[model samples]
Target: MLPAVPDRAVDELGRTEGGPETLGLLVRDQHTRRLLLLRAVLDAAESAGPGVCPAAALARLREDWALLEEAERLEPSAHRRGRPYRDGPVSGRPDGSVPVSEGPRGSVPVSEGPRGSVPVSEGGAVPGNRPPPSPVRALLLHPLTGPWARDTLRALRSGTGPLTGRDTREPARALAHFGSLAAVAAARAGVSYAVRLTAHDGVLTLPSLGALRTGGPGSGETEVAVVHRRGRLTLRRPGEADVVVRLQSGAGAWSEAAAWTSAYTLPGLVLDSAAVPLDDLDPYRTARGGPRPDTLSGPAVLDEADRKHWLHTWSGTAAALGLGGERRLAEAVTLLRCLVPLAAPPGSVPGGAGGSCSGTRREAFGAVLSSAPATATVFAATLVHEIQHTKLAALSEMMTLHHAGPEARHFAPWRPDPRPYDNLLQGAYSHLALADFFQRSALAATLPTLRDAAWAEHARYQAQVGAVLPALVGSGDLTVRGRKFVDRMVEVYERLAEQPPPRGHAARATAYVQAARALWTRRHAPGE
Candidate 1:
């Protein structure tokens, strides 16, 4: 498990009097609120079993107002509405359920306040009327009640929020753990967490804490309540059964039976307990103004066989790469929170597709699994490659790399179109990680065939990097610091490049990548 934040530092809320602007940029914009919340919870959890007080949590938010504002400014305008909520037919309610009506868009206007401050009501209810609406309910009714509302409720309920502590390292790890749990939970359910914020009269409705009536895993369970008490999360009567499952700290475990039995039928694939089988959702094909091939729609069925297959591949790959430990897996899962399984498009190769969102959507990291069956090695390499992209995206938010401007486009070895300096950097960084993965796999493989394959992969990636590095090094678009960062990356790549692959295979791998590059340039490059 990752190290815990010290009580005093967490209590202090990790801020300094006046730090360099670049220091603030080091942390990704999307992660600001979450990082603060997790650190606060860790501090509170350590002090008392029940967690921190609501008032204290609110105060902590005030302290981190600056960071929160910066994050908000950087968030994409399209996603400012928080998670997407769907308006559809209702399923049967398990128990203790209330009727939920879909209201008009912008039914409730969100009141603005200073960055992280809870939006306050303009006026109180008349004395003759029923008592004033609960602040929490009113806040929930507002459209913008996303991270602010969630964090405040957690703090109010658990008495934990951000602290005044200056320690950043421990809190970062705790946030990573928190992210991992959320990702694992999403993967298990075959559905991303929908931020369903609704209000009937003065009552507030939050779907995340409420039971999902979908007939999938835990579908039979009439009501599933999420309880945060004593620094732990509990799912009461999860699945279509009468059993309670506790999500322990650091590592999370779920009921295998519940996971297998639950199934959600969606547009493209049926998400069951174990595996996500691809359907005609046509997720592999990208179209203009339409959802990306990786975009998920509707409910998914959870299949036991599929889920087990996925877990086996995931866990087995982790073990093969010596990353099978629970904490490491959790971190990887956290980094790869979204999993979209895609059906291969016409004339397309069957392979995994990876992507990471920019700006405030950094946490929205995900990959689309191919319809084809792949070995554990393929899955492992894909995971490492995609997660590395996510890591770089997050890092880019904090530091200036290439100079900002429209610069001449250069060929990215992997892509057909010319890319700007930044996109080139992204490809290079991800391929570098791929090369490293192959290098490590080469060392770890026991079978001669597998070992040879790993070497071939390493050489392929190395050559791809070599093809692009010269352009990156010579480009005037890079800042001095950015150039230095690239230099360090080159150093690592050069060291690995020296490790020759199996004799004949090395030359063949290099030739293949070079030939591909030449073909791409011929097809896409502008004529002199």
Candidate 2:
């Protein structure tokens, strides 16, 4: 069952962004929500009862589910933190299942929810807001969202009133592919597990772990025996043995080498025993950095050197993030399972001045789509900012914060054009996190020059969020509770603003706020 959220927790998220319990609860809740989707998918297929589902695939699906159950059976801590597990749906129902709908990407909002902001993904053209993944784990494989899992769940339930299962074909087949999670779960629970893992586009992409590039063609189905035991995760196939790169230490190579059958597998990143893949090889994630600042929709392959560059950049980013705050860094690491690199545009100046974004779906909850920054500090800032969006996106699933539609009608300092109310909330929330980061940095900086730079950033985002609060509170778009949430945010701004900004920044921060609105007014209003 999904954990119940306290009303006060909602207010606390608004007031303080989030601390341990709040953040932990959000992460824990996501893990539960993903499980809920997995269960619902199982139910939908079983109720179809072998008559509709392909018999062989159906049996495998049951085994797949069984293996996951076995992982829990052997180790119940599968539900606890630091255990394992995303990239699926959220539960709003008593049974912890999402009522299937026929809208855009799985869940069709019958009441019409707002579309998410577009970014580095999908040709830099705007894609719809990525709400919670519609609980279908299949969406995790392919980058595209469509409709069809025919005779599966979408077709089984008609006019179910609001959710959409047709976003992809063969969702049941997709569910079977989900069997790949069995080994991942077992390793996480520190128990032994073995299961036939399905290859997606010639790869077994394990969410928290890494992918096994089985060297199969894109046109067919291939299965590999994925086994986890004694702190090791291994993939076995026919005629080929792929090498594994330990993403993080803790894992040992399998002692049993005789198990064979995975076909033509190529060496890739292998994660076991609590290792999380900071991956770039996964197809669903951006392979190369694109123009979009946050999300990368397009996919490309990075050469070995490029891959090395990413590892180096991340190593630096992780170290720099450590300086932010001990507890905050720990929470960030927990919430941040992986980082996908965002390629810097040519001629880009040194340091952060680039884009990065956190995941919006259940399957990708702890991941971020980011660019490689030259400076560690700016890179850390991008993470701090993006993680806030991650937090808020998860929170939005827990509570209805605003009713902003698709239309852009509000001012956001971060955006040039007007933004939708929901988008505005995301920006304010993230900027608050940034403001806090800068505040801490400014205080910690020893040099006068460094302190000034940090405080300027602190002043800019702090003022920006505060100036925009009225639009959020008065916009008539936020729900009553959402207003209360924003109200707490206003209080936070006031408390932070009371300390005067460094020299030249009070006016500069005010101008930064005024300048953004002025530019927005000029473009949006033009005549005014």
Candidate 3:
């Protein structure tokens, strides 16, 4: 027989005497706001005097800001009528009952800050009591809510196919364990918890008598709710097609059950729990026990700090690019920031480029050509073009698990062609392609000054490529095939330039695709 449920619930039947539980969140929000302002100030200071300012001072400010923001953001919003409200827009809306973070008791941790903490909904009245008309099918859990709820929520949304995918299953299993603990706690507190498993068509709904809701795509919205009670655990739903849960203080009424439903359906209850090793559950693990391709690593696996850095760099670069609208610039910078780490490594750096690589490249290295006006535009386009080349190369490397070896130079195998010479030609063409593509699809999306920048670069690249390529290929020993390859590469790009701008990404992407394939096909031709 199980013990009585513990009465350590966040909510107590204290009647009207209890003051509001949400006042703490306001304090947390204040800290968060202050931190944001500090970050902005630090960014301005660093940008103002990149060389003059001490690196330590800048880093200190940034760290403090992040720490404070996390503490504030991670804290649970005071629950109002069972729903949790996070401090920022990033948090799901006010009526969202999704648990932000699991509490220490396997319940939702009431997050007060952005730190590694839990966030509770704003209101509370126990969610399972209000069941939606239709059978619950799915549940979305917020990361800020209960650990088990958040974990399970992550699992389902990730779709490694439920019991698979490390990101999905690991969280699910953690959630399960947390649910078990919560159940034990609830049992002690005289509250019942139960688990109900239902399957309709291919969809599997795991319901508990707790609050749960799915978040918007990528928003990490709260999706599931968890509750623990004495006797039987129950999982129910709030609406149709969405899964919810409810828990009551009773046991053993498994009658008239639907084939889709089996056993306990209460939050924090696991009737017959089984231990599944986290590694085995994740399908991303290979037969050899190695991680699969999509496994998180490096820049592909960006943390919050990386995300922030990306945003900062992108905003700075876009502004430098002379993008007029700050809002558009900010968004573009954010996207670009996401893409930067994924960008190709431009040749082996002599050593690691410091944290502010892109910034230093812009301000110190000075890629922008001021005199020729168009020179800056061409440089920007070329950089983007080369960046794409790197992206393509990286993708290929990941697919093959091998990097491409340098092709033997036709004239002198011992002395390879310089990167600059190659990059100059490649970048020129790429600039044309990217500039043209952006102009067509995202015209309004980009600031007008960008077009002027691109045009300037186009002219500069054309002049440089025409002058340099001839000298590089002039060596008498250069092979016909090699010469043809180079000539065709240049010629095709010239033709591509003359052709009208591509209609959309499909057309633009296709242009590169076809050209590359054509080049490859030409290489294997019989006449060679």
Candidate 4:
């Protein structure tokens, strides 16, 4: 059973007056927040008439504070805040057990009702003069741990929907549109959801109720139904025999059942604590970056032990880097879904391999780590590098940075092979982040040896960035927006370079980058 929600509680909007108690539930649990938001939309649709008045919704939320609070004191810490992604075992069933009948659960059957099916108009304002309703007919689910959440909430409160290029409408059509929009947003955001919608008898059903699945058969399933009861809105689900769990009023009774299935065993990767072996690789795994094998030849799972150790390392790194806020840390982790282990090829470094698929498969932004890292520091650094790739990939979708043309391959200091303009941009952005990470480490280092090592790393990354920035600026491949992006990157590097490192370390780092460039030119240049 879940803990009861506080009566006087804050929501994602920081509104403390009477709102839906479920918002309090969403504030507490980051994993299930999206599911609850979906539930709210379905409920609102069932209750609303032809038109959904934003004013009426807001008024209802304000008057219903008591049911949600229930005498429990709402604490600030109960709200979802940014924290390091912990690898500790996610305690719960992979697919939560719902008390439903023993049978193969299929899609809900559509049935006729007394009111009859109301044919929803495709898109337009209501016939009569009613104040423009909220654009967000479907509730927007914000990330519990990132800056995006705050931005989304602000937009929602201001009567704007996060989804673009969609016609907002009454409840039935709005629910359908939201399902499609959410899937697109999740793919772009590097997140995944098990969302399925079925409409029957003027009601909608969310099968799976926001739980992530491993696609294994015979797993238990839960379905949430939004229906009208005696002209009042109610959310219903099956319970013990002859008993149905019906939730009405503003109280958040269904909050406890929402659980986050963070870890599971995929075809080629084991996320969280699952001990399943990888027999075949998922086709979604990208072929770029690292070696792509047909099947698993060696260890391909991120086990429980490694997860705990790496999370500890990440926590320490975040503290050292002054990234204590939930938003900052969540920015890194929210885009990172899972880590898969890979076997290194012959004659290659065993434990020093990391590959990101953000460029090719933006939807599957999980990193494939080659062999477990020898230390937490290595693992943390690899995570930082890979997630940066995901961030840049998402940004590229929003704004076109480079011109569309035949790929212009160029010499990259880190990769042995020549890289295309897009890949080059990805590397530059990631290395810039690495430089920031090292700078933070250097500043926070307690011992002289550690400080010196950190400073050397910081200088090395700066030199690499300095080398790449010029090529990016001169490539002539960047669009106007692309040029602006590269210019901002250059500005950051210039600021960091102003903070000079130890004289000897700076010289060596600069010389190393120059030599690497020279070697690349000799090999890859025309008529060398």
TM-score of each: 0.49, 0.68, 0.22, 0.46
| Model 1 regions lying over 4 Å from their true place | 1-30, 33-302, 323-373, 404-408
* Tens digit of per-residue lDDT, candidate 3, span 114-168: 2211222223111222221111000111111122332333343444233343542
Can you tell me which runs of candidate 4 are displaced by over 4 Å? Answer: 1-299, 302-317, 320-330, 344-360, 365-371
Best by lDDT: 2
Root-mean-square deviation (CA) per prediction: 18.6, 11.1, 26.2, 18.4
**lDDT (Cα, 0-100) at 421 in candidate 1:** 81
Model 1: lDDT of residue 132? 21
Give per-residue CA lDDT, model 2, range 1-528, as digits (tens).
456667778877786455545766786666545434444555666565443455666566555544444444444343333444321121122432223433211321121111111111212122333332121222222111111122234533432334453433354455554564445544545555556667756766664445566665674566776655555566767777844322232212222233211211111111111133444554445421224433333333455666665556655665455554443454454465555554544555535343333333334666666555555577677778777777788888887888879888788887787787888888898888778778877877788987898899899988889877888888777788888888888887877777767769878998888988888888898456
lDDT of 1 at 253: 29
What's the best-to-worst order under TM-score?
2, 1, 4, 3
Q: What value of lDDT does candidate 1 attain over all alpha carbons? A: 0.40
Tens digits of lDDT, candidate 1, 47-105: 43223333332232222222222222323331344322222211222331222222111
CA lDDT scores, all candidates in order: 0.40, 0.55, 0.28, 0.40
1 versus 3: better TM-score goes to: 1
Winner by lDDT between candidate 4 and candidate 2: 2
lDDT of 2: 0.55
RMSD of 2: 11.1
Best by TM-score: 2
- Whichever of 3 and 4 has more TM-score, that candidate is 4
